[model samples]
Target chain A: MSNLERIAKLSGFSKATVSRVLNHSPHVSQETRATILQIMKELDYVPNRNAISLSTGQTLQIGMITSSINEIMLPFLNGFVEVAEQHGFQTIIYTTNDDTSKERQAFEDLRQKRVDALVIISCVTSAKEVESYCKYGPIVSWQRMDNPAIGSVAMDQFKGYTLALDHLIPKGHTRIANALGRTYSINTRSRQQAYEQAMQKYNLPVLRQFYYPSTYTILDGERVMRAMLQQSEALPSAILCSNDHVAAGVLCEARRQHLRVPGDLAIVGFDDTELSHTLGITTIRNPIAAQAQNAFHLLSGPLRGIDMPQAELCFELIERTTT
Target chain B: MSNLERIAKLSGFSKATVSRVLNHSPHVSQETRATILQIMKELDYVPNRNAISLSTGQTLQIGMITSSINEIMLPFLNGFVEVAEQHGFQTIIYTTNDDTSKERQAFEDLRQKRVDALVIISCVTSAKEVESYCKYGPIVSWQRMDNPAIGSVAMDQFKGYTLALDHLIPKGHTRIANALGRTYSINTRSRQQAYEQAMQKYNLPVLRQFYYPSTYTILDGERVMRAMLQQSEALPSAILCSNDHVAAGVLCEARRQHLRVPGDLAIVGFDDTELSHTLGITTIRNPIAAQAQNAFHLLSGPLRGIDMPQAELCFELIERTTT
Candidate 1:
């Protein structure tokens, strides 16, 4: 006999009743469902997930579209995956490598019903294009969106950047150099604006010689410091980095040059990674864990009886030895 | 008209011809398939992946079951995801957190045809239990297994450990202490064995006081050093760590205590992560990227006209400032 028939015979329930329990239908009582599941477990019955997915229209899977898996993205991904697993949902990741075509393909996969929902991290595609897929499934993004139909849980990067500058400027640091990563990204633009606005508020000049454009890495951070030292203009008393890796890099290079931190060249970094805590680099806590949890909850809102338009998590300054 | 009918009308082909192209049938000529696909793209037709999966009995999705998303797993996961995406396959990740039941469920998911293949990274389940699922679909593992039915791509941890010891012992270091991570794991056991064997080969006594049991983190490294300092025994001249993070932590604590590196205390670390490079710690290269690529290829071997029983990648020693 088939596994379903065997389960029906053992549980004293009809085949249809056992099938309902397997599909997780609400029509069956909890007690009766438990009994049937126990028998199925005893029989070592493994239900076909694809068949159930087709019937219930629930894949029990969450898809995430990311630019790349690097130092900055790892923590966020880890947090997101933890939350997803706790909720009994598997995560399917599509790394687009910042390619618009790949991003579109990821959205297309969602439309094809591969996953129940999608959370996009650092998207390169336009908002309008992304918004079009909301009809297919719930779509969430790391960037804040104007449309109420889409869900977003973004960290206030502008506030975070200002928090860094605010900490440095009070220590009589007017000539603060800055490191920006990926000039085209919205996050980077907001951070740049924050630096400019904070400088203007304090009546400080935003000089070209102080600008360092490098991606997130310790090597990048070291390269920025090297470039600064080689420049003909006088070095800034303080440098604000894009992330902890860059900050750590700056600290390494500064140490090599016998520059005393906070005395000769103060450093401030974003994303309080493990590197920051280990090396004691003062940085802004990006709240990546909270963002991941909030994003997952927002995407799974309908199922969990939760309703919210958007969530803007706050970033806090973590003081350490560097500053 | 339906998507298939629309594509058929636009491409001047019958509905069955377009359907064959959509399902990726071997009967369809490449030239014909290309023409139909172009027309479907022009019309913005997205054939349902679930429907195709049902008919073809292929999900075109690879499932990975891992313990957790930590420092070591991140690189492997990223590498695997990149390779899978290049082959037009989506990756579904199941973070079991070393839970045997969850590991079983991951295999059951494979048995139920949710994925075409599965990769088990750091499994807690017994080989027999894992081998049972091979009949359902292909299952690859990170750890080396004696069973030929199961596919495996493992790095020789024994050689990796010896590589570290050989590099250190040559510099007239006899009193070498070791820090081990995850004592329960086979990899850790192999590393411990290698250390003991190397010590025996050099006619050096393996002191119990020098053995530090700590996991893979910079914090753990610092704690080990602190614990050692509090003990009555004199500190060993050189120490070996499980990974770069631990090495970095030891360095930090050593510096805090004003101990001179390579003079007062020589250090060696494994996994040559970014921390090792930035801090100039000598370490053994783990070759995580190569392991990932080889594992994926081994799992997808049947499809690519490649047949291999197993693959064992080697590790190399990288000399840095600390040694």
Candidate 2:
């Protein structure tokens, strides 16, 4: 016989009565419940969480759907998990690698009640398809979403770019260049647009030769910087990089080529990571931890029937000697 | 009514028969099974994984207990998750921050049947305590365990140190120093022993002043290097850093102080991460991905009744300009 059946037979109660006692239904009398609990302890009948979830309808899990994992995503994940663990929830990360079908499967996990809520760090899926699942559970994203029900908490990438450019232009730099990450991402697009607009504002020509599409690694920075140095055209007065790693690469390559930083080419990097601090690279401080915290609160607040205000987090610029 | 009862009513079958069909029991007639499946589809009846897990005793999930999340842990996690996903299993990571109680709770999660197997990256708990839970499920770790049931797949830290020291000694360096991460870790202890052994083998004295206990970040490297520079004793002719980040920091600080690398201070780094590639820091290639893969295969093969050999992975020395 199963543990439940054994408990029922030993306590002189039906299996349903034993289950009711296990679930704390309160319909069972105090004396009968005490006897059932005693028998359960003697039998070492530890209640399975699966059965408990079936009765309670709460998995106590929060699902996170991320496109990729890297150094940039580390702090954000750490912050989100910190808040989640405080509220007695575990975060299940599903890395989809920007595949729409895999992202849809993650949403299906939400529909199946494997998790109480879902947080989309990044995705390739349409906002409307994502919105359809909001009714099933609370959904939040780091990107801006059209649906009012879906929580949108994100950093102002455009402002981050403008801040870096503003810092450079005042230092007598007119022929400036920009090296960014994948063009497909929303953050990259925003920064690229800002770069163009800021150049237009200063009446500086936007040189096509100066643009470099770089990846997030330090080697990508070195590759792009090498290409820039090899070109016949005079190097741009300054360059804006995607992140500190890429900037560190740019600095290393420039040193290799015997080019003086700020004397020959002024460089600005984004995401004031630890590398930036070590190398004294001036960078824009992306508010990753704050954005992650906001995303979590947006997910949990609504479940408690508390209204959360939709807001965009801001970025800041940290000045160092490299600029 | 629950979806199960609704499907039964629509198919004119008993609830138990519908459940048997859902559970894929061969006792159900083929026609009846087809009809019940059709009814389930029509009603949009999605079987809950929780209920299915209770019946099948398979959660299709793997539990990972890691001490913390940092740059060092990222690749190991990526490798493990990739293999786990390919095998149709999801990995649930529990960051214990080396907290003994929290690590025990993760083990308890296994005993409660939440995960089919457990992979321990690092923990503060004793081996015997960890081994007791092996009978509950498949267990694997990056550290060596006394129990035969637990899988041990780890890199040879002693050999890694000896490789670095031997490489440096051939270059005519006697005043060599070493900087490492948390001293309490087994990896650190092993490396320290190897450093002492290699120094004695060379008939050189191990100076206490030259030993630095540094963390994983580049900033720690800078701090230790700064302290070394200010000391009354002459700086070591060469330094062996625990990892690339610290090595990178030492190089940066040396440059700031106008000390030429390999001229004033030669350096060797461990964990040939992306940073090492960018800065051309000679390092020991810690095979993290291969170790993660071995750990997963060890866990899965045993569950299939396939005996896996207990093995220790080796590290390699990457030649670069820093040395």
Candidate 3:
């Protein structure tokens, strides 16, 4: 016999009564509930929670899609998860490694399982394509992309990069180089736009040789710096890195070559992570916590067809010793 | 009329035929199915996937429990998620931050959603406590802990540390001090055992002054080294750090103080992560991909009641410029 049937037979109750007791229904009488609970323990029967949830018609689950779990992604996720938990909902994170098809597959899978909403982080999928998935549930993007169908909690990368350039320009530095890591990333593009705009405003020469590709972590930063040192005739007086990890690398390489930071080469980085603080590198503070909390609010929603708000978060320029 | 009823009326069929078409049943004729599909699109009705999944009785999903997503945890998760995706299962990771009650809540929540299994990484919960939860579904640990009910894919930290010591011992180093990151971590405890055991065997003093607490990231490593430099009467000839991040800091700090690696202070680290390679720090290779693949296999199984074999992964010491 199945567990429910056995419980029903032993408790001298119908399947529904036994199920109600198992579900902790207040409708069940005290004596019978006590007897049923005893029988459950004695039989070593753990009730089928899956069946109960399906019958109740509430999953209380939200789905998140991320490109990768790294220093950059994980902190935002932690903030997302924290807010999700506070709302009495559990988050299910799906990684796609920036593959559009894999991201679509994850979306289909989560939809099939009936997640309340989807939080997509830095996906390359078009707004029109994402709108189709909006029918499944509410979709929120981590990066701010203006889509009628999607809500986004975005940090102003343009303003952030502009602030970094402003910091270096005041320090009496010209011939500044910008290393916007990952040529294809939207973030890289946005930061690059700001860099070009800022340099053009000041009439500072933008050197193509100094622009490094695929730089993310400390290792990537070190590799880029090493390559620049080898390839370039003369290194720029100051370098604007995409993130703190790259800035840390530039600082390390400077240490190796007996060059003083801000004296020999001024460097300003994005994302004021712990590494940036340790190395005393000047960087922009990414509003990770704010983005996550706001995204959660937009996601755990009245499921679709509301005027989605555009939340453009402010960025801060944290100056210490690097610049 | 409801979506199914509207489709049936428009397609000149009964509600049962439209329901069959919706479910993709083989019994439905192709002509009728095509007709019903056309009507479904015309109606612009998004079917409730929850009802469909309930009727089908299968949800190809798994759950992973993690304390935190950091440098150590993120790589392991990437490996786990990679294998799960290959097996046509999507992973929903729950971050507990090492809180037992939070971990318990996540277990209950995932079980309710009927995840295929649970993969826990370095949880503080006891074997017996976790084994009890195994009645709901198969529970596998990411860290190797010997328990009949729980299957684990654990790296031999004792063996890993021993290998590091053996390498340094052969290099003619007697005054070898150790730095165990996280004073109370199980991995720290296990690695400490090997460190002490090796020192005892070699008739070397186990100095308390050399040991530092909570040294994980590069910043933490730098702080510990600085503290040692300030507090210690005489620095040890060699230092065995917990991980590569810590080792990198020691190397950076060594440069700061004009002390060369291996020449002034030889350093050995654990986890042959990419940062270790960049700095050329001699460290132990953590079999991240291997461990993740094995853990997933253990979790996504024909549930309980079979002899779950223990998967003890081996460790390797990578020699580099640091030591």
Question: lDDT of all predictions, in order shown?
Answer: 0.82, 0.81, 0.75
lDDT of 2 at A315: 79
Clashing residue pairs, candidate 1? none
Best by TM-score: 1
State chain A's TM-score for model 1. Answer: 0.86
Q: What TM-score do all the candidates reach, one by one? A: 0.88, 0.83, 0.77
Off by over 4 Å in 2: A1-56, A230-232, A304-313, B1-56, B303-313
Write candidate 3's Cα lDDT for A122-146 as tens digits: 6766768887888777788886557
DockQ of each: 0.51, 0.30, 0.28
Top candidate (DockQ): 1
- Which 10-residue window in model 1 chain A sums to the lowest lDDT? A303-312
The CAPRI category of model 3 is: acceptable
| Best candidate according to lDDT | 1
The root-mean-square deviation over C-alpha atoms between each candidate and the true structure, in angstroms, is: 4.2, 8.4, 8.8
**lDDT score of residue B103 within candidate 3:** 73
Which regions in candidate 3 have their CA more than 4 angstroms from the true location? A1-57, A109-113, A182-185, A230-233, A250-265, A300-313, B1-58, B109-113, B170-176, B181-186, B229-233, B249-264, B299-313
lDDT of 2 by residue, B233-315 (tens): 89888999988989999988888999988889998899899888778889999988888888888976744444445346788
TM-score computed on alpha carbons, candidate 1 = 0.88
Could you give candidate 1's per-residue lDDT for residues B1-323 as a string of tens digits? 78877888888889888877766555678788889989877776656777767777788788998887777667788888998777656788888888777787789888877788988777788889889999988888876665688887777689999988888888988888888876677777888899899999889978668788756787888888887778787888889898888898888888888889989889999887877888899999988877888877886665433453434567889999898
